[model samples]
Target: MARLPRLSVTDLPHLVLWQGHNRHAVFADDDDRQAFLALLTDAAAREGVELHAYALLDVSLWLLVTPRRVGALPRLMQGVGRTYVRRFNQRHGRTGTLWEGRYRATVLAPQELLAALVFLDHQPVRAGLASAPEDWAWSSHRHYAGAASLRALHAPAAWWGLGDTPFAREAAYRQRVHDGLPPEHERRLHEAAVKGWPLGDAQFLAALEAQTGRRARPARPGRPRKGGSKSVPKLS
Candidate 1:
């Protein structure tokens, strides 16, 4: 089957994810992580995308960003992927494809923005890398939870919705992480990222489809049987 086109639009928040081929450890040490982060930081600046939340795991990474231009995300991802892969290979003295495939991205509805951010933050905990999100050194959770201050990057405006003051926001966000997300919620976010579907409600999906004129969801799993119950029609 043909690949689905990515849903790209300006000023919309997107959750992006990409992992190492075969689930390999992409970061050997802190230096490797630093190199990858530098590439991402520079690419975001050059491509005009706003960096919001991010998490760097052993084999995968996630980013929350809003692009200022139509194709900024692609450009940013291309630049980061190329540069980081090259550096990683040279530093580690190994070769082959660095990534599993093209990164996956999903347009996030307004209400889902915070959920996505918190989800990204919780990756470390979920992976058993850290007991709490605030303990993770490679995530923007530090910035959100007041564990770190990143001068160059700014939090998404939607994050401010947590509270009026920084402390309030940080406290509230920590509480959110502490409270944790339901398994289904996390599953939806993960599945959407993997499938490159827009993460939103019916209205949000409809709006995306209307704006892009392309399907923003995955096709149904199976073909409808020709003859079902005669009295009850099959739902599409």
Candidate 2:
């Protein structure tokens, strides 16, 4: 079956994921990780994509971002992916593709935004790479939890639901993570992200389809197979 083109809904936040080819370790060391983050920061700033929350794992990374205009998200991802792959290959003496293909992104609804933020932050913990979300320095958890003051990472407007003040918001976000996400929500988030489908209610999907003129959900009814939704649009 032919794959669907990626949805291009302007100004909506998306939960994005990309992994190493064959699940290999994409970040060989702390330096590699730092390099990729630097590239992301630059590309996001240049492309006007807001970096809300992120979790960088050994083989993959998760991000919560909102692009200011149509094409901003794709441009940011492409810039970072292409540059990072070049640097990674040179720095580590490797070759060929670093990523599996095009990264998968699922548009998020306003109601699900905070939960999505928590889910993004908890990825390290969920992967068993850290005892707690705060222990993962590569993620935005510290910034949101007030453990780190990283101005580069911004909290989404939906985060204001926690509180008006910075301390209140941070404390609330911290407690939410401390309580942990429900297993079902986590599983659903994982499925949506992996499948490149919008993670929202039926109405939200309908709204997205109206906006993008494309199906907001998976074209097929069943589970998305490995490599089922890969689409590498020309990066520029």
TM-score winner among the candidates? 1
Q: Give TM-scores for every candidate, taking all chains together and pairing residue i with residue i.
A: 0.92, 0.90
Each prediction's number of clashing residue pairs: 0, 0
Runs of candidate 2 with Cα error greater than 4 angstroms are: 218-236
lDDT of 1 by residue, 106-161 (tens): 88887888888889989988889998888889999888888889865667776788
Worst 10 residues of 2 by lDDT: 227-236
Give the CA lDDT, 0 to 100, for residue 101 in model 2: 89
Steric clash count of candidate 1: 0
Q: Write the per-residue lDDT of candidate 2 for residues 62-119, one digit (tens) a residue.
A: 9988888779999998889999999999988888988998899888887787898889
TM-score of 2: 0.90
lDDT of 2: 0.84
